[model samples]
Target: MPLLTNREIAETLERYANLASITGENAFRSRAFQRAADVVRDLHEPVIALMDRGDLRRLPGIGSGIADAIETLVRTGALPPLDALQRTVPATLLDLLQVPGVGVKTATRVYRELGVVDLPGLLAAAESGRIRALPGLGPKTEANILAAMEALRRRTGRFLLGTALPLARRIVADLQGTLPAGSSVAISGSVRRMEETVADIDLVVSTRVHEAIPATVAHLPLLSGIVRHENGSLRVTTHAGIPVDIVVVDPSVFGTALIRATGSADHLALLPEVLPSAPTEEEVYSRLDMEWIAPDLRLGLGEVMQAKAGTLPTLLSVGDVRGEFHAHTLWSDGTATILDMVRSAAERGYAFLGVSDHSRALGVANGLDAARLAAQRQEIEKAQRATGLRVFASCEVEVHRDGLLDFDDHILEALDLVIASTHSGLRQPRDVLTERLLRVIANPHVDIIAHPSGRLVERREGGDFDWNRVFAAAAATRTALEINASPERLDLNHDLARRALEAGCLLTINCDAHSTVGFDALEYGVAVARKAGADPDRIVNCWPIERIEAWLQTRQT
Candidate 1:
């Protein structure tokens, strides 16, 4: 696509920064442009407007070169130098630099020596041992490069919550060891809100630990490789192949830093309206004066107004969750047995655990038929009686390709909880998908809608349900929306969760765990819900045991 306007200029500059970072070019020049682009993106007034007013030069980090570039973009709608560079360096060559280990020198060498540009060409060269033949490139290095590239592809141009969460946890743990006494640390941003895919991982540490950040970050077991370390921030790649960035700041500024880093960018842009004159992030939240709002709740949809008016819905936190709602067992694609699942929940101090094995429609998952489901329920009841843990017999009943529940009403009525979900036919027209979902919501036996959107982060496309209709139906039917916590499927993403709440729909954060290991995945779902601005009161699982039982009973009636 042809680059046009200030936005395009900003994007082109970003490209320049990425290329510069990869190629080992003049680092300061690249950083200057990147920072300038960030400033432009964050500007409330249009870049063109700032240029027309001759005020572009006044913005920090926007030097004479960037000022001239902005003016050219505003006037001629193009950057001649950037265009000329694109011609000199094949666009394909630039793409090669996107590979994790590919440097500018390597990219230049590949283009000059092997005439290889782009991923496919590079892959072929690596396979043919041509990449290993390059000076300073060994066979093992070439293999590692190829492996990294493949991992990158699977990552789908985004960070997976599954990988990022553990690394963040480790970093937080390490910070505890290095920080001054009474220091606090947390993982914030989309990871905190439980989005399945993350662009970056953000950590906020409150410490006199600022001075020790470098050593703490340097020693992290996850830091198999360090990409860059500047100031108090460090970016590293974990042994598990996920990239993470850690920022260390003082305790007083922790809230502001958390808010700043835990941003959707779009959400942060709307903040000035909430606090017209507050320049710093701390001031932005302090204007309304509540222990700064959590990053996941910064969705910009009037959270600030609610905070100002003292009507902000109390968002759900990790502690509010009382049970595992959408879990599986050996009966249907889960690694644990019903008894094992119940025992694990009890060990975690949960008041209840919902055993929601897959229903028969998900044949590939070895879902349970009525006979098996009945047996599983009996087993769960036996386990509950023996272990003293309340085990709710639930089923993740699939909404078939034809949009009907996997189990008939008779079977659904027998369950303690039924979480209806769509496992196929995601590409149906919006209206059809909406109607299909409405039917499931209206089914008196279905108590919750699991992973309503059916997105698998960057791997699978999301469904086409008309959210307005879906949320309305959920509200009317009193069906809770499940925030599936699996890293690959943090479906019912933050925005949808917010809309669900606005429409008076209840939300539940579920691990959708297939194994005991998967039970920890609730963090991701909670992160998405937090980002959606969900409060503890709106999340049914956060309720006390009696309250949860009452709610479930109400759904049954």
Candidate 2:
């Protein structure tokens, strides 16, 4: 047996907290458990080690109650509270919690009244007009739930990109070492494209004999079980439960094999042509008199035509980003101090850093009020003076459903930048959400709109809105849209990002970092930008500080 990763343990606690919330537990107690998960995630050491040393109680935010819960999970692989709640709340209601707008109260109402047991059941109820009859719910909410469940179905059983990428790379590296010197191995499929969710890791090995694959793969250390082995491919599950597929081919046709293997299937169908024995992917494209496409852009979404016409835009790279506009510090909910985050950005060779903590409208994020915002600005300027790095004070002002920002004009006008975001009252009608966002974008003080879609990757569905209208409003108002780089919320995902580009909206790739290490998420953002055919010319963060500062001066009311 292996010790559970810190993230795994924290996630288990988080689910327990959610379950507790639905099972009629005290609100404060449930929040405490949720905070404990955050504490464990932030701690650098292996939490299991702390338990073994009997020091779990000493960990910050770990009270005796949480400590006991942690110990039970580590020792027995289950939480007693969660187990008890499952019996009381029924597995069906717990499953319902996975839907975005369907909260515990709503779930409870539906469960008691309609006995909604699963997504299909919920979908049927909503479609048949049964859900609208529940207390506090109406036709609009039923539609929202119906859409959310549809989105959830598409992502069911998929692994997050961040988790799957590293594991896939490690497996490829290990497999490379096991093969003969002449052979080469590469990872393809969704891992290569950086899709938010992946079904399985795809591996392609260019080696002489197809029969050579299974023997070495069979003896690998991590292999827990084999799913299948036939026709030059093998399917297996790792001990960690990640699914993997291996495609073996001869080295002579390595390039074509890789291109075919790294496809969306639909993307490959649009390829001008495919040929064997192309030494490299570039050559395959060159053979058809087309420009090479980024692996991330192989989405069957007109890249082929763009290449043929020589109109393919150069995509944004991690190297192009120069600053961040959405970051948090201890003044808000961030784990890092302002100066620490600034120093990290400076060390990364960034030209500037924007310390944009959350505004008071979002109290759950430890958002700052006007006074705290002013105090934070002073601290940021002090750091700028000492570190010789440009640190701009900014705020992520909330866009209220009533079409107002969290801060007044007087407060917002004082900041170097304002990133308006949607946080509270997200479950509004499509027209209402669009109008609220349009209002934020139109604010002369707001330079950017962070996480425009308000989607949490695979976890939550994007709020229903008229994005075309939002994009048109952002363009008209000169409000740049943000590509939030956080792994959990890579908002402005590839598809919508491309659409934003077409709508002529300028974009910014920001880390929305909460800690020093969060800057690393910039790479993921760049990956998304590239996938969407975005370029430095349209990404404001790619500009030098002088340019960005000059642009900021123009946004003031």
Candidate 3:
């Protein structure tokens, strides 16, 4: 049996939930499985180990039934109920759910009503005008579905960074345990660069015993099958359906092989035609008379010339960030209490933590009204006194369609920080959306714009706003634009973030955490800032607490 990572376990549970949804089983049961998947995925400890210790049921949302299903999966590598459900539906029907706007309900309707079992079938149905005549779906929905299909087609082979990185790390850890002691195994390609989406995973191995690799890979539980093996390089397919390329090289040319595998073609093109054989990347760059470039900067951009000129800007790192200004507690939909959040922040060496629960406009999240917001502050004060960690009382207030904030100025002014975000109207016209953002940026009480694009990577496209105007207004108002660190929403992506800095706008990288484990996502946000060449001085949260407090005071006045 293969060793299942937490992500794989979560994915297995999610598959059951989706299958249940398609089978029209009890909706509550499906949701319970989905929530269990969420908790398992975010767990710091291994789910299997918890099961081994008979502590799986202690996890929130893990009841006896779900716990038993997990045990079956761990023990036999199969869930009988899931296996039975899979036989009832066309396997291809689940492919329709990958399209952005196609939910399980929509997929079920199309599968039952239109016989649309896959992306191509869904596209054909939408194009033929067959879907418009359906009971609830109109012409607009059909058109949107077609658009989503087109978008999905453009990036069919890519997986989000969040999904691919963890899998890659798990593979690396597994190999470290199983491989020869002196072997060097490291991730390369876009996964190392931390690209928002990766086409494939790459591993560069430095080992003298090349013959041992193929035999060892055969035993790696993470892989489903070997794709190709030749010339000391192996390609394998993960159980998650991702392709991984493993290039084994002599320890003598390991640096050369890594350079060949890691860099973009254009980035390599600008370098010397002949390369030197070295064991370290620093030596490889030194042989070429260039500075050691960070992996994220190897995007074939101007970094090559900058490296030669010795003028690469000092990029912001995860450690440079002292704290975060956008996070949540149980005051909203968050899973942890204020005290738990503060203790987690303290563990991470954060100087201060912001408790920005959702505002009343976001009713689905159980957003806090004015009274609830005030009551939450009392808890925040208690947490601060308990932990000696400065807890900033704040709210992630919503921006209405008409550009008004969810809370009045008087209420917002009383908070230590105010993060304005748009929960709806993301599809508004360009002029209207840009205007809405401008209003939020111009608000004296508004300190930051969270997840400025409202985009979910590879799922939904972002709003089409006039960014130049938005950046200019933000520069004038000193409103920091957030690079939300959530795996699904790394908004103010590197390109936009760099442009925002060019327009003199301040930048902030926040986790937008909903739980204690949520802070772990801060690294993704820092990746965005580093890719944009942002400095710690420009990120307000990276400043000392006194300096951050002074800056917040300036915005209020």
The candidate maximizing TM-score is: 3
Instruction: Give the least accurate 10-residue stretch of model 1, judged by summed lDDT.
Output: 272-281
Candidate 1 vs 2: which has more TM-score: 2
Q: Largest lDDT belongs to which candidate?
A: 3
Candidate 1, 256-353: lDDT as tens digits: 67666677676678565333233245565766564355555666667766776668667667777888778889998999888888888877778888
Query: Can you give the lDDT of residue 108 in candidate 2?
Result: 63
Residue 49 shift from truth in candidate 3, angstroms? 16
TM-score of each prediction: 0.63, 0.78, 0.84
Pick by lDDT: 2 or 3, better one: 3
How displaced is residue 148 in candidate 1, in Å? 22
Deviating ranges (above 4 Å) for candidate 1: 1-156, 175-196, 203-216, 229-233, 246-290, 305-311, 535-537, 544-557
Error (Å) of candidate 1 at residue 345 is 1.4
Q: What overall lDDT, based on C-alpha atoms, would model 2 receive against the true structure?
A: 0.82
Ranking by TM-score: 3, 2, 1
Model 2 RMSD to the real structure? 6.0
